[model samples]
Target chain A: MKSTQRNMRRDILDGLHVGIPIAMAYFAVAFSLGIIAAKAGLTAPMGFVSSFFTRASAGEYGTYTLIAAHAAYAELVVMCLVINLRYMLMSAALSQKIAPGTSRWHRLLMAVCITDEVFGVSYAHPGYTPPAYTYSAALISSLFWALGCALGIVAGNILPQQMVTALSMALYGMFLGIIIPPARKDRNVLYALAASFVLSGLCAAAPVVSGLSSGTRIVVLTVLISAVAAWLKPVNTEADGEA
Target chain B: MEKHSVIIYILIAILTTNLIRVVPMALIKGPIRNRFVRSFLYYVPYVTLAVMTFPDMILVTPTPLPGVLAFAAGIIAAWLRLGLFAVAAICCAIVYLLSMLFAG
Candidate 1:
């Protein structure tokens, strides 16, 4: 029993060591997200609750857009699901990393905080990951994420209009940061990204498709573009770490 | 948005996102074997984020010029593989600078 306690404590400390950097990064990004939430008319408390529970930038961004549009609840559901579908893949990958016969509750708890950065660090662990490690990492990062968001909203309310306008682009910058690295490595990703940009631009301008709500357009385009890319350039799961 | 509606939306966001994360980790034990499904999932983030970034990014700013220029700067910064915070900071700085230039 003493050894088990020692091991768990070590895991928790290790988690914190890795988690601090992730926590800092999340605070910066979540700050931008909070600013966007403020633009969408969300109160600081609202931003805090949203980030605390969701912990997903892209998903929350879509949700804010839907909220601003006064979109239907069904639209919100589908948009959240679609924007966050990548988490499903990440979670599946993580499921295999947990030792067999680990408690189901631990798996659920770990899953609750599996953002991209957290998953990256957790999956890099040498052997089967201890639940305590992930729990500690998640706890530190999630608190920062929520706090940064609430503080961002408060700051947004005080900052000048021009500054807020500038900050609004931060989310897009982060999105570019995400997609561009992969595009730089893979030709297929670059092509898919370029195609998405062109098609999305066209859809916004075209007569009928332009009429679709922004949330609906994003969902439709994501499915359509990704499906075609998959059909045309099916990834070799054995070779590709991304899958 | 009303206070109640915002609360409901936040709940929906939480539930839907957690469902995607928890269900697979809790239930699925094996790697998905289907090649097409794997490929599709692999491409989803790039496509979805790319779609979201363009057009909307340009439209979000007060004027088109600063938005366009800042976007180009952002793409360059990101293409160089700057950290997300750095890229975002660069974009925000560029927008602020250019907007001031245009305003003056």
Candidate 2:
């Protein structure tokens, strides 16, 4: 019991090390989402609630776009579903990192915490996060995300409109920060990204394909465009990542 | 109209959101052996993010110059490894400054 307690403590510290920067970055982005939501007729409290389940900036913003159009709930549901579908793929890739004996309950818990940032940080961790530590990571990250949205909504509401409009760019900037790290270190990543542009652009222009909601198109095109990098499996030589 | 409907609506709203966000993550375990599916899952994020950001990088202003300059600003900020917050702040500041200089 004492050993397990020590293990938990160690995991907690390790989780803190990983979670803070990612969560802080996430908070900055989510704050802008809240501000935008406030501008879009959502209250600060509603922004907080909408953000909890959305767990992603692009999809949440996209859904807000639909909501502005006064699109139906079905559209909202599909918008969120299609945009967030990548989480399923993310979760599957993650299952490799988790040990096989991990229980259904544990899988469910980890699944709930499967935000892009969480997956990104977790995947790149130096070692396997003990199942013991996963909960703390989830709790800490979720709290930061939810708190950030709350801050954005409240801040967006109180702050002048000009400032809120300015902060909206922060989300795209966050994406640049994410992509550049891998892109700089690996030419292969750059190629994959460049291909994403061509494929997504083509997918956008084709008349038959272009009519679909942006969410569905994202899932279809990204899956197609990213096939090269993923097939080559850049990080696969490390056996530990697979098992 | 019923008074309790608002409470019901909120519950429904929260429940609906949770269902889309959380339910499948609980149920979907799979064989998932096909190389295409496996690889597709892995790179979905990179491509998805790229597609999302492409427009911003491509078309920032009515005239291409301001937009092109903002594009350069973001590329430089990102290449410098300034992290997420700094990249965002620098890009926003540069855009606002440029807008003031040119658009005004």
Candidate 3:
């Protein structure tokens, strides 16, 4: 029993050590998200609540966008589901790494914490990952994310208009940061990005399609572009070691 | 949006995202074998984020010139593999300085 407790403590500490950098990165990104939320007229408390519960930047950004657009509730639901679908893949991958016969409750608890970075760290762990490790990492990261978002809304309210206008660019900058690095390495990603940009622009301008709500338009484009790219490129799971 | 509506939207986001994470981890222990499904999931993030960023990026700023300049700056900074915070800060600074330069 003593050894088991000691092992759990060490795993938690190790998780914390990995989680701090991820937490710091999340805070910075979540700060920008908060500013966007403020621009959409969300209170700081609203931003805090959203970030605390949602804990995904792209998903939260979609929520703020739909709110700003006054999109229908159904549209918001579909957009959130589409934007966050990647997590399903990540969770599946992580599930495979968890040792067989681990408690179902533990699997469910770990699932709640499975962000991209959290999954990356957990998946990289040798052999089966301990639930305590994921729990500690999730705790630290989620707190910082929520705090940064609330503080960002506070700053947005206090800052000058010019500054807020500038800060609005941060979300796009972060999005670029996400897609650009992968584009640099992969030709297929670059082509897909270019196609997505042009298609998005056209969709926004095209007479009938342009009439669709922004949330619906994004979901449609995401499904269309991803499906075509998948059919054309068909990533080799064996080569990529994704499975 | 109303306060109640905002809460509803946030709840929707929370539920959808958590469900996506939880349902798979709890229920699916085996790797998905379908090649097309795996490939589609791999490309989803890039496509979704790219579609969201463009056009919207240009429209976010007070003026088109500042937005265009900041977009270029962001692309370059990110291409150089700067961290997400750094890229965002650089874009914001560019927009701020340009807005001041063009202000009456």
Best by DockQ: 1
Q: What's the residue-level lDDT of A30 in candidate 1? A: 80
RMSD of each: 4.7, 4.3, 4.9
Of 2 and 3, the candidate ranking higher by DockQ: 3
Model 2: residues >4 Å from true position, as ranges? A1-7, A39-41, A66-70, A131-141, A151-162, A184-186, A201-212, A228-243, B1-36, B57-80
For each candidate in turn, the TM-score is 0.75, 0.77, 0.73
Which tens-of-lDDT digit does each residue in A1-243 have in candidate 1?
A: 999999999999999987776676677668777877887788988898889889987788788877878888888898888767767766876876688788889989888878766775676576889999998988898888899899988885576777767867776786776678778889999999999999999998899999985656777888899899999998875434555
Candidate 3: where are CA atoms >4 Å away? A1-46, A56-111, A114-141, A152-155, A239-243, B1-13
Can you rank all candidates by DockQ, best first?
Answer: 1, 3, 2
Q: Give lDDT for model 3.
A: 0.80
Expressed as tens digits, the lDDT of each residue in B1-104 for candidate 2 is 21232223223444444454456545556434555555655566667777766654445344546545655677678888886667767766665666566646
Name the docking class for model 2: acceptable
Clashing pairs in 2: none
lDDT tens per residue, model 2, A97-207: 566566777777676667666666565555654655555655676667777877886765576443444455565676677776778877777888788777766766778
Better structure of 2 and 3 per TM-score: 2
Model 1, TM vs. native: 0.75
Clashes of each: 0, 0, 0
